[model samples]
Structure formats: structure tokens, C-alpha cells
Target: MKIRVLGSGHSGGTPMIGEGWGNADPKNPKNYRTRPSIVVENDKTRILVDTSPDLRVQLLAANIEHIDAVLYTHGHADHLNGIDDLRSVNRAMNEWIPAYTDAKTWSDIVNRFNYVLEPLKNDTNVFYKPCLKRNDITVGQQFEIGDFCIGVMDQDHGFMRTLGYRINQFAYSTDVVELPEESFKTLNGIDTWMVGALWEEPHITHAHVDKVINWAERVEPNRLILTHLSHRIDYETVSKRLPEFAELAYDGMILEL
Candidate 1:
């Protein structure tokens, strides 16, 4: 299996519009992040984790043309806003994509893009808008998408709840601050864990550097890749602080398992 880091930055992404790279170096391309998203794929299937606001550019940069499924972590704008860009994929693939998410997240998505959730018209060739088949999932549920057998667990995002996904030995937990006991049990013994860590300091809604390290110590994954970074984190400086088993995720980084 291969996991591609489509975008690794926090909600605002690195080098915010009004505020430039906070602690990040301008010379390091690794600090030039977009939004949070990833693509998990094996030889037969490609599954997108989230449609980040930078999905278009991210997909282009990664040279990804088609995806079999989309799994949403939550309804945050950074994670869900770029959903409209999936229309281009719909047009290219000539089929409706299957998107999986919790009921509340689906509700938020429906409120925003109701049209995309509507049934496809009889004329399938008309790909003017995104056509998606909604598959409402629940915590602790297990499902299969192509070559993946996925397990879902509940995550606490402080203000709201999100879903973490486990597929084979690789698990993804983004936009989360607290992993419930059940979620940690689900993540136990994973080989690679790509989790969210906004910065070095403690955060109300997202996990920080120390917090993630603590979690990693418990789960003890062979490789721990931190994602959903903020401008407050400088690549070179933060890299030195992490243990040898852990590393910061950069845009376009690919991990083969």
C-alpha cells in the first residue's frame, strides 16, 4: 500500500494569506504546505481521505487522475470545502464516486453541497457538477472499499467529533485532539500512523507535538508521521525534536507499506 500526503498544513495552511510563514523558513519548500488531505492506495484502488481546499493543485502535483472512494474525517472547511473540485474527477471517470463519512459530517456536507449528493441524472455523460453517492458510516463499523478493509473509530476534535480510519497496518487520524480509549485500542500495533499535530504548544482542538509523542509512545507504531501542521512549526527545527521513529509529513510525501 502507498499513502500520499496530498497536503500537510493546518486549516489556514503554511504562509497564510495575510500572515506569511510564521516560524517556518521561506527557503524550505517543505514548509510550503497547502491544506490537510491524503490519498491511500494499493495496486488496485485509490482512496482519498479528504478533499482539501487545495485538492485541485494537490491532485495535479501528485499526478492522480482517478480515485475509487473518499473518506471524510470531519466537516471543517479546510477538510471539506474543496469537495467541489471532485466534479473534475467525476467528469474524467464518468461515474459517481462513493464518499464515506459519519452522519453529522454528512449532514454538514449536505447542508453545503446538497446538489452533489443528489442522484445522478439519466444522462450520465453530463458531468457539469460533482456526483457522489453518500455512504453514511458509524464509529466501530468496518467496511470494504476495493482492496481496503477499513475500520472506523471515534475521535474528539474538541468542538466536534471526527472519525479516524484504519486500513490494514496503516491508520490515519487527522483533525483530532483526543483519541478515545476505543480509538487507541483500534490503533494499537499499527505499523504507520499518520496523525495531526498543529504545533509545538498545546491546542484546544488539535494535538500538539508533545501530545502526539505521548500517543505514539502508547501505540508504538514503527513509523509515526505527523500531519496537519501549522506555520508555527518549522520543518528543520521540529524534525530534530522528534524521535527517530517519527517525522513530519510534507506535501507530496509518499510512504510505501
Candidate 2:
């Protein structure tokens, strides 16, 4: 299996429009982060996680031509705003994509982008709209997308909730501050963990660096990649401080696990 970090930055991304690269170097490509998103794929299928506001550029950068499924972590704007871009993929493939998310997230997504989930029109000539088959799942439920076994767990994201996905020994969780005791069981035995860490300081909605470090220590994953990072954390500086098992993720970083 291959897990690719399509975009590793937080909602606003690095080098914010109004506030340029705070502590990061603008010349560094790593500092040019986009919104958070990833692609998990194997020989048989390609599953996209989160659409991200920068989904089009990210996909173009990664040269991704096809996607079989989409798994949403939450309904936040940064994560779902690029949803309309999927219409081009639908048109190219000539097939409606299947998107999986928990009931609440699914409801929120459909409520906002109802056209994407709506049934396709009888006419085949019109191909400018997205037609996705929505699958509402429950947290902690196990499901299959092609040949992979997926385990879902609920995450604590302050005002809103999110879902974490685990596939085999690789787990991806972001936009999270706390992982409930019950959810720990779902993360057990994961060799690789891609989690969120905003900065060194505490954050209400996202995990702080210390909190993420503690989680990694407890989970004891062989490899840990931090995502959803903000400009407050410089790529090279943070990379130097991270433990051997953990490091910061950059856009287009591919891990063949």
C-alpha cells in the first residue's frame, strides 16, 4: 500500500495570504503547504481522504488521474470546499464515485453540496456535475473498499467531531485534540500513524505538539508523521526536534508501507 501526503498544512495553510510565512522561509517549497488531504492506494484501488480547498492543485501536483472512493474525516470548509473539483473526475471517468463518511458528516456534506450526491440526470451528454454515491457509516464500524480493511473511530475536535481511519498497520487521524479511551483499541498495533499537531502551544480544536507526542508514545507506532501543521512550525526546525519515530509531513510525500 502507498500513502501519499497530498497537502500537509492547516486550514489557512502556510504563508497565509494576509500574513506571510511567519517563521518559515518563503523560498522553501516545504513551507508552501496547502490544506490537509491524503491519498491511500494499492494496486486495486485509490481512496482519497478529504477534498481540501487545494485539492485541484494537490491532485495535479501528484499526477493523480483516477480515484475509486472518497473518505471524509469531517465537514470543515478547508476539508470539503474543493468538492466541486470532483466533477471533472466524474466527467473523465464517466462513473459516479462512492464517498464514505459517518452519518453526521454525510448529512452536513449533503446539506452543503446536495448537487454532488444527487442522482445523475437521464441525459448522458451533460457531464459538468458531480454524481457521487454517498455511504453513511458509523464510527467504529469496519468496512471494505476494494481489498483493504478500514476501521473508523470518532475523534475529539472541540465544537465539532471528526473520524479517524485505520487501514491495516497504517492509520491516519487529523483535526483532533483528544482520542477517547475507547478509540485507543481501534488504533492498537498500527505501525505508521499520521496525526495532527498544530504547534508547540495548546490549541482548543487541534492537537498540540506535546499532546501528539504523548499520543505517539502511548500508541508506540513504529513511524509517526505529523500533519495539519501551521506556519508557526517551520519545516526544518520542527523536523530537527521530532523524535526518531516521528517527523513532519510535506506535500507530495509518499510512503510505501
Candidate 3:
């Protein structure tokens, strides 16, 4: 399996519109983040996780022309707002894509992009708007998406709950403040874990450095790649602070498992 970090920044991304890079160095390109998202692919399938607001740029940079499916972690704007960009993918494939998420996230997407969910009118072309087939998922359930046998668990995201997905030996868990015990069980024996660590300091809705390190110790993945970083966390500084087996994720980072 191959995992690509399409975007690694926090909700607002590094160097927020008005505010600029807080502690991250401007000279380091890795500090210039977009938003949180990833692509997991193998010989037979390519799955996108979260359609970040920077979806267009990220996909273009990654040169991804096709996607087998989309898995939504939650409904936060940073995660789901760029959903409209799926129209571009639809144009390329000339087919509606399948999207998997929990019931609440489906509701959120439906409420925000009802038009996209609507069947294409006879006069409308597939390229004119995003077309998606929704598949509702439940926590603790296991299902298959192409070549992947995925297991999902519930994560506490402060104001809401997010889904954490484990595909084979790799797992992606972002926008999480706390992981339920069952979630940890789902993550057990993973070889590589891509999880969120917002910054060095404690956060109300996201995981901090200490919390992430603690979880890493428990999960004991051979490789721990942290994502969803804020400008407050400097890549060089945090990289030095992490264990040898753990490191901060950057946009375009790829891992093969």
C-alpha cells in the first residue's frame, strides 16, 4: 500500500490569510502547508481521504487524475468544504464517485451540497457539477472499498465525533482529541500510523505533541507520521523532539507499506 500526504496543515493552514506563519520558518517549504488530506493507493485502487479546501491545488500537484473512492473523516469545513472540487475529478473519470462516511457527516454534506447530491438533470453534463453516491458507514463496522478492507472507529473531536479508518496495516486518524478504547484496539498492530497533532501546546479540539507521543507509545507503530499541524509548530523543532521512529508529516510525503 502507498500513502500520500496531500496536505498536512491545520484547519486554517499555515500562514493563515491575514496572520502569517507564526513560528514556522518561511524559508522551509514544508512549513507552507495547505490543509489536512491524504491519498491511499495500491496497485488496484486509489482512495482519497477528505476533500480539503486546497483540493484542486493538491490534486494538481500530486498529478492525480482519478480516484476510486472518497472517505470523509468528518464534516468540518477544512475537511469537507472543498467537496465541490470533485466535479473536476468527475470530469476526468466521466462517472459519479462513491463516498463513504458516517450518517452525521452524510447529513452535513447533504445539507451543504444538496445540489451535488441531486441526480443530474437531462440538460446538465456530469462535468457541470459534482456527482456522488453516498454510502453510510457505522463505527466498529468493517467493509471493503476496492482492494481495501477497512475498519472504522469513533474518535472524539471535541464538538463532534470523527471516524478513524484503518486499512490493512495503515491507519489515518485526524481531527481527533481523544480515541476511544475500541479505536485503539482497531489500531493495534498497525505498522504505520498517520495521525493528527495540532501543535506543541494543548488544544481543546485537537491533539498536542505530548498527547500524540503518549498515543504513539501505546500504539507502538513502526512509523508514526504526524499531520494536521499548525503554524505554531515548527517542523525542524518538532522533528528533533519526536522519537526516532516518529516524525512530522509534510505535504507530498509518501510512505510505502
Model 1, 1-257: lDDT tens per residue? Answer: 99999999999999988788999998999999999999999989999999999999999999887989999999999999999999999988888899999999999998999999876678567888898899999999999998788999899999999999999899999988999999999997799999999999998999998899999999999999999999999999999979999999999999999
Clashes of 1: 0
Inter-residue clash pairs, candidate 3: none
Which of the two, 1 or 2, has more TM-score?
1
Residues 150-250 of candidate 2 have per-residue lDDT tens digits of 99999999998899999878999999988998678999999899999988899999998878989999999999999998988888888898889998899
lDDT of 3: 0.94
The whole-model lDDT of each prediction reads 0.94, 0.90, 0.94
* Every model's TM-score: 0.98, 0.98, 0.98
Better of 2 and 3 by lDDT: 3
Off by over 4 Å in 1: 121-124
